[model samples]
Target: MTAVSQMKCACDSCLCIVSPNEQAVQKDGKYYCSDACASGHSNGEGCGHTGCDCN
Candidate 1:
């Protein structure tokens, strides 16, 4: 298989793709597309991404 260089955001409800070459956020050994997701909330209470309600 091809070498994997990117991955989906670690947030359970997030749909963002993360790449080591971008500004993706890193937390607890997982990668997130933003600080909110990395902090466990894409927004203040949940993943701010549209349609995602991860908390």
Candidate 2:
């Protein structure tokens, strides 16, 4: 299999794809597509991504 360079957001319900070259949020060694996910919803109520209920 090809080497994996991109990954889905660390948030359990998020559907965003995160790439090393992209400006994604990093928290506790995990990659998140937005600050809401990185902060574990501390800054906001949820991930805010469509169809995602990460909170």
Candidate 3:
């Protein structure tokens, strides 16, 4: 099978795309764009990527 090189952040509201094997934050088998998203934004933080407002 072909490997996945990129995908949308697993966060429900995130707009950033990430490589699952690269700079992605893995949580419960899902790939997120940042630590904030990986933690469910419990700290009122966002991924901080340009154009993404997920928090």
Better of 1 and 2 by TM-score: 2
Which residues of candidate 2, in runs, are more than 4 Å off?
1-3, 50-53
Query: Which residue pairs does candidate 1 place in steric collision?
Result: 36-41
In the range 1-55, model 3's lDDT, one tens digit per residue, is 9999999999999999999989999989999999999999999988888888788
Q: Name the candidate that leads on lDDT.
A: 3
What lDDT is reached at residue 18 by model 3?
A: 95
Backbone clash total for model 1 is 1
Q: CA lDDT of 44 in candidate 3?
A: 98
Candidate 3 least-lDDT 10 residues: 46-55
Candidate 3 wrong stretches, greater than 4 Å: none
Clashing pairs in 3: none
Q: What's the TM-score of every candidate structure?
A: 0.66, 0.67, 0.93
Best by TM-score: 3
Model 2 agreement with the true structure over 1-55: per-residue lDDT tens digits = 8765799988887788888457778788888988887877776577667777777
For every candidate, C-alpha RMSD to the true structure in Å: 3.0, 2.4, 0.7
